[model samples]
Target: MSNLKPEPANAPDDPLRRTLLKGAGILAAGSLAGSALGLAPAARAETSAGLGGRLRGVQHFGITVQNMDRAFEFYTEVLGGTEVMRDGDFFGDRIQNTLLLTEEVRAVRDGVNPVTLGIPDLRSGAQRLDVRFIQFDNVVIELLQYRDKEQPTGSGKAFAPAQDLTSPAFPRAMHVCFYIRDDVDFNQFVRDLEAESARRGMSNVKANRIVRATTDEQRLGASLDSNTNRITEGPSAGWSLIYCKGPEGEQLEFVQVQGHAKQVFDGAYESRRKQLGA
Candidate 1:
């Protein structure tokens, strides 16, 4: 989420890139297919487009957590992610200044009365922002823990395990989804998730059914059904998925996209483009 570069406009266009853009509208939709690098000359090339594309697809998924160690273990040890970088005690005068913390905010966090306060101090009550980056395939997960900070009221509790976070009513509610290898067995993955949940002593960490699109279903397109935990229709149709809760009750999804998933998405994108008269 930090040090992100800009997208290049002068990058030479490739046929595949053009085709993908014509189909999906945004590179992110097909980024997993390695189409994001189409603007660059080679893999990990240092071209401006390459540098920009790295920032474009997905640099990292940031997660605020109560305990960094627990989150790290859950991500790395349980979920088979690899730790790449860590920044402990990562806060400085410049960093604090960049955040532009006002005196009122600092006073509340520092446990001081802000109303009667005369001096305008802008330093944050937080001492350090401990952060760790975990790599999982093409994505990076940023696990952050705010240390020595005064937490607001009712902020101490983790997300409710049974909360319907996928509901459309909760606009900000979200889940991190991953694309699993095509050949891996979906049932086995579900079993592994169950085992991990039990091993971690998480009673609510359950895996949902791996929904695949079938012509027999009522819905004809790839759309998510939050209530049913099903992908009823669309490019993800026929693609299997499993949902589970992370260590901090964050929603997570693993999608099997090796088969007709791409075709489904491509068709959906193309349809939208046609409808829009693009």
Candidate 2:
């Protein structure tokens, strides 16, 4: 039997309605984590009030992809994500207005094809989007594919290629970090990642050597000064991390905390939990 299921109906046209729905999903996931961490209900309420009821936990992170199939394989097969949902046919007035994509739509209507801008000549309505949701443990990732209606078999329009994220230092660059569980062998995990990438011939994916932080200064310096030097005697003695690039050149990080570092983390969490009161 086919495992594919029908897509859910389009979300309501109201922007606020969509925001609330998205917020609900984030809250549902955040509540479980908060409860497990022993966050006090009253304190949580007060914190929200203090923030003017604006900020909440992240709902999901999205990445635009050129090839949905390739991105799906890299995320699911390589990174061990599970497909949660897939939806398409995202075009027309609702998308244009809601996403403020009217400029692109208007340009298309005025005969300003993508080819005129030196980009690929995508099929008509190339601004339309296809989305796939994948979940990795607690985090959800949304992979977006901008597509358009199919053209004739020999139509000049071609699939766009993935763009390189030249450097993390570039403006507006962003990366996602995944925390490795304490029980997982950090070295072996990286090795397995490399092996899988090799097996799949994912040439664009690359990883740096794992860096171990031996001192609290080194840990802090890694972020502030980009220092990777080792030092003796500090709380972060066993913290290890590695930076990598995904198939689309997106930056990623994996970290494993151990030794004194794990103790420090546990203590901090417990202290916060207690401060919140139960």
Candidate 3:
């Protein structure tokens, strides 16, 4: 007789059977909820296909700043960005509704006791947000400045203390990364960044030493590499990178992709160009 016993039939106690039953129950509940919500069949199908089916590429990213003029000067002079538009003095019922600022939020902003509203105090206190769009070569950034309705312009009272984003370990800390143009010398670019900061009296802006991904392991582990399509030993096997701080201590990263990496990037760019018929 065979030493191994035949696998038992999938009973209710079986782990795999339990898991399948749970998954089916969840799916059935979701389908029922969708039907109750009057979701069209096509809409349900689209949802089942995932959000990527309806979503397009990124439009822009936003960063809140203390001083609009100072931030604008730093971005344009130091990093080479163009001013796109500016809008401000936003306040009213419509704006409040759009921002989902409830009465509790408004009460908190107005320095009212949240206990009266039967809720905890909300952190956001800005009466309005002034926005300026800056366009870089590859991306658009929206710079937002919160304003207090009662405070005078440029009084600095409207702004909150800056958060410490110096460490990547900080929760919600984010950095913008840019690619250096092929024509630009990577070493010279770092030198220029430091020089510009000093010349512009931006003491807060600082750049670290360049780091090179030279080994196959390093290339494979590069930030841009996808898990499914990693760059192991391609012509763009390695890359040069630098980390810097913006005037307000916002982290910035620059990369110059080398070897097979560049080839891969260029191929994608060409595909996008062809898709756009440009």
Candidate 4:
């Protein structure tokens, strides 16, 4: 949910990504097909569009979780995803539990320096078992578990890292949103969701009114696309949220968005604060 880079305009790949995106849109609607659709470049090149919402497609996401095994199953089996990679090469030793392979992890693993962003939570996390899984579609979801921490109590401020705040309050900034395509087969998707919920016996499964209102509020307040907003559509009023326990007992969210999920910055809503030297 961090926007370390505001715009990738200067990057050389922008033009190519745009071209591929157009082709992908056509492919989605079946306007263009032949051997071209089967070609690897046709799909690979479009991955960039999927990440930035440029294609009006998908927005990449990362979910913080506790149980790598169960969470992975929840994502793959329950949510209907195909596993691209089953091993951990991102970490030097393929350690079951680690955040994205940051360069500093080696320095810390080798006992040369403490891990970057190492804090009490990391230390506490070391006591437990967890894992990370990245899907082929450039959708990277990380699952975590704190042997030391308990699941979220949920009545108070969510302990996860709020956009406006620095440093995690509860730890493992919880929850993740999955922005799916607009044309997903609604009937089957809902039936499977219901079946999965029932089979998994997940707690607090509901249409979640708070999420719908928030989605509408963001769309209306920010002058953004309401129809394309994935968070605002569905029988659950176009969007739905379900509270699920992460592998570590921390509360996690399986959010289904109709269009895209965007990031929020501190003081981001001030209309007069556009970047300028005025």
Candidate 5:
């Protein structure tokens, strides 16, 4: 998945942050690394009270869908995500009320296009939303079905280039990723993704390799290491990432950090729990 920012130019030289960066790759997978690292020292300086810090870690990913049952089948039957919690009515009152609170929603209701504000196509008529929360390993996935409204129709194709690791967009949140355990059959997982995409008639489900683990210098537009930025140091040394598109055009990443799960998946989890006294 996307929604991650590049590393900052001026991050403090805290030993703890350095250590965490080595293990957690500067920030969590879907985090704004630059912003997080930039504000970390300031957060520390201003907040010494209990449980006071920048965000601990990611909790879940949310997405709006057109069909609840179809999306549920793809996530549950295909990806094997376990259902955790779900509560919503097909009427969409709660969801519409929540959306109406946002400036983008208001602008759309005024019959103005909102693509620049990241709110594309104002849907007319009743807006309905039902939700399904699923857990894939440690990450929680939220699937929302928003319907009964007029939305710009599409050919149901995803065209964004996959090579752009950072999918720079208006609402920068681009994708959701899942960790592939060291013991899992990697080939089978890839096959499964391909099969699911084919089943849904989406041709965008192809795998792309992340040749290098991102570095702060790289974030500044430095040339990649001649060796192709292969993981040579840190917890993810020698690791690789592969990604694909889901049925409804959502980017899905499956990371393979050989020998162990990335600290972002396992370690950051503990850190967040400790931060929350869980």
Candidate 6:
């Protein structure tokens, strides 16, 4: 999805936050919210404190969504994400899938939308993000949307290139990524994406690119002060990343190359956790 400023530890919860968290990327609140949200640390501390072994692999990813209901419907009923954790939206006063750990959305979404409309109007549902969230499976996936966003950006705009193939379902500058297990099927999955996009008249879906990252870029990532994107530069040696965009100028990132993604995470997470001493 998108990333925003880190949440303050003392920042009290608010209703308007629902809009802010949607597509804000840096969600530090709500279900599954990370350190960005106060509860994540508590979850980690609760788990870590009790005692558990390191994970063999990532179990799930956390992301923001616009229409929690529609997303839930699409994911659970359509994609088959077993309901994990869900609750009410503090702001909208509506029921939402605050937390849903799914494995299906990761395998589809982009590919399916394209098939529904081949070379379709890039503006259609492209940027209309009704829902967004993370998925769980053999691999982890993150889905994002623009239609349901009500979050205040202080002042920011989506950037879309003029000549990029226009899409009605997924716009430019908007992006979400799926983290594939090292052994996850690659070719077969691409075929699935292609087939779905083609079926929907969105043959243009094949135009999308699949990128593989390197661990070197992950370590080389620039500091938090990196740039306007708040993106860190790759370490020049250990890791790197891949970037893609959907319709309406949403940016998607495949972060920290496989081998090196954890380098910085280890240092940063450890340091932050120690700082909190939680």
**Index of the highest-TM-score prediction:** 2
Q: What lDDT is obtained when candidate 1 is compared to the true structure?
A: 0.52
**Candidate 3 segments exceeding 4 Å error:** 1-48, 93-126, 150-158, 210-236, 265-278
Name model 4 segments beyond 4 Å from true.
1-62, 86-129, 136-138, 146-175, 185-191, 209-278
Check candidate 1 and list the clashing pairs: 213-238, 221-233, 221-234, 222-233, 222-234, 223-233, 235-264, 235-265
Ranking by TM-score: 2, 3, 1, 5, 4, 6
By how many angstroms RMSD does model 4 differ from the true structure?
15.3
lDDT of each: 0.52, 0.57, 0.54, 0.36, 0.49, 0.34
- For model 1, residues 91-153, the per-residue Cα lDDT tens digits are 444445444347556777889875344321223334444556676655668776655534321
lDDT of 5: 0.49
| Model 2 TM-score relative to the real fold | 0.65
How many residue pairs of model 2 clash at the backbone? 0
For residue 43, what is the lDDT in candidate 6? 25
Question: What digit string (tens of lDDT, one per residue) describes model 6 on residues 1-278?
Answer: 23423331112653225433442332322333443211144223434443332222233344444334433443454334454332221212111222211222432554554323322121222222222343333333343332312332211222222335434355432345544334534433444433553454432232123332254244224332221121235553333334433222234443333344445555565575564444
Top candidate when judged by lDDT against the true structure: 2
TM-score for each predicted model, relative to the true structure? 0.55, 0.65, 0.59, 0.35, 0.53, 0.35
**How good is model 5 by TM-score?**
0.53
Model 2: colliding residue pairs: none
Off by over 4 Å in 2: 1-43, 52-56, 100-124, 151-161, 210-236, 263-278
| Model 5: residues with Cα > 4 Å off, grouped in runs | 1-57, 90-97, 104-125, 149-171, 200-204, 209-235, 259-278
lDDT of 2 at 76: 91
Stronger candidate by lDDT (3 vs 4): 3
